[model samples]
Target: MYNGEKRRSSYLMLFIKNRIGTVLIFSVMPLILVSGIILYQFKASHYEKIHAHLGTLVKKHKQNIDSFLNEKLGDIHFIAEIYSFHELGNETFLKEKLETLQQAYGPVFVDLGVVNSHGVQVAYAGPFKLGKAVYSDADWFKEAMKREYVISDVFLGLRGLPHFIVAVRKSVNGDQWVLRATIDFAAFNDLVENIRIGETGFAFILNKEGDFQTKPLMDVIPEKGPYMDLLESDTKEEVQIVEKEDELSGNNIYVSAFLKNGDWLLVYQQKASDAFSAFTKALRVSVIIIILGSIGTIALAFVRFKNMAHHMEKAEHERRLMNEQIIETGKLAVVGELAAGVAHEINNPVAIMVEEAGWIEDLLEEEEFKESENIAEFRRALKQINTQGKRCKEITQKLLSFARKTDSKIQEVQINELIEEIITLSAQRAKFSNVTIGCQLQDGLPVIQGAHTELQQVLLNLINNALDAMEKGGGTIDIKTRLNKDHIVVEIADNGPGIASANLKRIFEPFFTTKPVGKGTGLGLSICYGIMKRLGGDIEVQSVIDKGTIFRINIPLKKYIGEKQDLIM
Candidate 1:
């Protein structure tokens, strides 16, 4: 049966270990898997969203440029209607009227001209000679002749300068004609060059043929290979692409969106490094917080576990010590009982010897024995025997004190007189060392009900300790008593190398002592603590190493004595 039980316990232990391992793995594995899935999804979704958002930004930018062009062209169209209807068949008059209208629209438009159906420059304004320039072959003029109105892509003009053209066909004097406007492309380039959505986002314009209308503001020329070919093929469709290339730093994804009217693509390209820089910084901080939180959780758990383990070990150690103390206390009880009985039994013999010694001394003093030389020696022996017997009795008395409960005898004791009495009694003892005892007891101290003998014993123990601590070079021991508030305070202080700073607080603990082996039972302060507590008083100590130690015993002056007489009767 014992073997079966052992096998069962072993199986249970193995099962617990397996369970712990399973729990640890299951707890962390799911988090790891979930985090991986979430991070993958987050990365994929973020990239798609960034691409979509970039495309949207470029599309809006293209719309804004288109709208601005249409508005500027509308002003020219209104002027064309005026020239076609009011100034028909008169080029010089039309030119003069167009200049006044152009001046009202401000200086942004450089020149306005009227071109006849034969592509002849009929009317001109703003620093260009009439009949010197014709635009029958210009793309805008050809498109406008077919489609009434069109805007030309940026190209070098007759002045060897880059510019864009707006053309609109109208009926003048019953003949179809084209009205043309020239705008400085450098100003347009400036407007396009500075266009940006965010810190690192850049914008540029491309024409219907996928040719650069304006140079891209980006540091690297946009990838113009397969990706650009695809974009150009789908000029009508707003599309975006993300491509990796060493030409652009970081993860370069160029976004392009087309304007429907001109097939012009407004492209913005962003490096992922700059685009997600803020998010990356935030992610780093979040990871640090999680790591710190996990570390703190583990550290706290470890500290709590260590504390609990220590408490359990401490309690077990105390239990063992308590059992040992109980066993020792039992032995001490037996010893005390034996001592008391032996003291009772030996009292008769001791009394007989003491009486016989008295008689012998009396006889030796008589003249009949005065001449005997050995009589003095006999008397000396008897005296020595009496002294030994008294010493034994004192030892037995102390031993018996441990066998019974100590009760305080309440009496109206004078504070100064008590201190004096204790000093006198202690001075007569051979065990007391050469410690200087002094008293600064206050005069006129109110008499209080307390155990006089027990209080004396408390003082005696403290003085003996001080003397022992002083050893050869005796130090001052001051006993003081005074009335404080509603209490009587008795303070005992010693100038001997004070209690070690570490031990001062535990001085009153039972069986705690600094005395050499066989010199103390270590019960003196413990008994003193119990006696003072029973007397409705408390003992407090303050000490600094190598300075001094002070003990303050406070007793309630107005102790409840029930219906007993106020005076010590």
Candidate 2:
């Protein structure tokens, strides 16, 4: 068993050593490598597309906010350029102008005020009571004086609501005044809120100081939001896309654009999972396809290997069977030569002995010894000599007959009668071994066309094997013959310590034996199998350990024409 396993291992190694296995490995490896590359490339391209898309959205919102603020600044410049200070001071005209501005653009501005170069509110229209107020130290006033125009961040003003100031500085007659307007923070909030990024995405504006310029569109403030540091950094890029982990949302993607005029950052943020949903879905599909393709390739390779292994094993089995047959045939040839030689040498002597015995008997029967006292003993001895001599001659003739090879002669023979003859020959051996033999030949069994001597040899071999199996236990041997369809089945079964299941397949292999040394030669069943196969028959055995064994011989009713012609030709 260990040797068999070692041989199998060696065969497997040999198979792997061949180019077929190498080809399989190379093929699969390249497919795996190509798949990996494709997936990586797809992932990179997906993220790039998402980044570009997000960047475009952020830029769009930035333009919208800038356009809104620039429009309001344009309104302030138009009012300052068209109207004089004294005309601006006319409460009714200023109120009319404010109403016209509000009616033209939607109520983005709460009120319009004119502050003198002294930083004092000289005249004002609408909500606040800053008419003729004292000189101011306000940041918007100072920035307006320095930069000619200024837009302030959102703050709680005199009205106690979030609002921002848009101021434009004007000088007439060498006297400077500021045209300042307060825009509704809610209007700015609406603009930012309307720009959507994804399902959870929104836009927010951060002041130059990274402070919220309006109420944030999302739940989290700029200070605590993911990508807060990027928002605060002085990045030179106009638009940037960032990915970060949010404390509340796990992962988030942020797109930020800097507004140069307002020194503000416009940020569009969404959950990473939401923003990359399409990318992730496509990735999953690609991975599944790759996995399925790999499985298919591997399954195909496995099937190919399995088929090749089966063929290789079958070829090896046939080669072994052919070698065994050759050895068995050589043994039979040597045995036949020795048998013919011995029979030829012994036949002449046996014939002469028989003649001499007849002559002695003839002399004894003459009158010379008729009255002898020992005549009866002499006659009996002569009779014994003649009988034994003839027996020797018969034995020699049988040996010569067995040694001679005859052409396969097909004839119609009754299988039942043939089995009866075999049983009779084995009766003495069965009785001597204390084994019971039973025959169950079906009545009116159909005749079969086969070589008589070959069929007889096959049945005789099976009976002998059955008797040998029961020699120790003295069990029962049952020989049965029956006809089924177009074939005749002969089953010889024995209730003895049966052949082991593991050894059953090799029972017909040449030189395989279970008997002790010198008790038996192992070629009987193998020879029987070869003869049956040549005569277009099949031999099969079933066995169970410690129970019994059955050998079934199947022969067709009519000899196979192809096999018969092959044998004769």
Off by over 4 Å in 2: 1-52, 86-94, 128-135, 158-160, 172-174, 219-238, 241-253, 260-262, 271-273, 328-454, 463-569
lDDT for every model? Answer: 0.67, 0.78
Tens-digit per-residue lDDT, 1-569, candidate 1 = 34534764565555455554554455545554665566667667776777677767666677777776787788778777765533633656766755775567555577777777778776676666645477778777788888877788888867777778877789756777877778767666766676675667776777755667777665544354333654556445666665655543656566766653636766666666666665566556656655675556545654554555557656765686466545644554454455546756787887788788788888788887888879768878988988977865665455444333455577887767877888787674414466777888888888777778877887888777777777766677888888899888988888877776446545655546788765775667766765565566767676656677888888777663444321111
C-alpha lDDT of residue 558 in model 1: 69
TM-score of each: 0.50, 0.64
The TM-score obtained by model 1 is 0.50
Tens-digit lDDT string for candidate 2 (1-569):
44555787678656645745665478756776877787778878888998998898888878888988989999999999999998997778888889999999888888998898998887888877767764477778888888887888887766678889999989989999998899988888988888776688877888777777866655775566654576567777878888888678778888888874537888888888788887778768867876787678767766676678768887896787567656645665565456558768988887888788788888887897899999889888878988878766765554444444336687988999999898899999999999988989899988888888878988998988888888887999998888888889999998888886457656765546888865554567766766676666777776766778899898988776653322211
Which pairs of residues collide in candidate 2? none
Error of 1 at 187 (Å): 6.2
Write down the lDDT that model 2 would get: 0.78
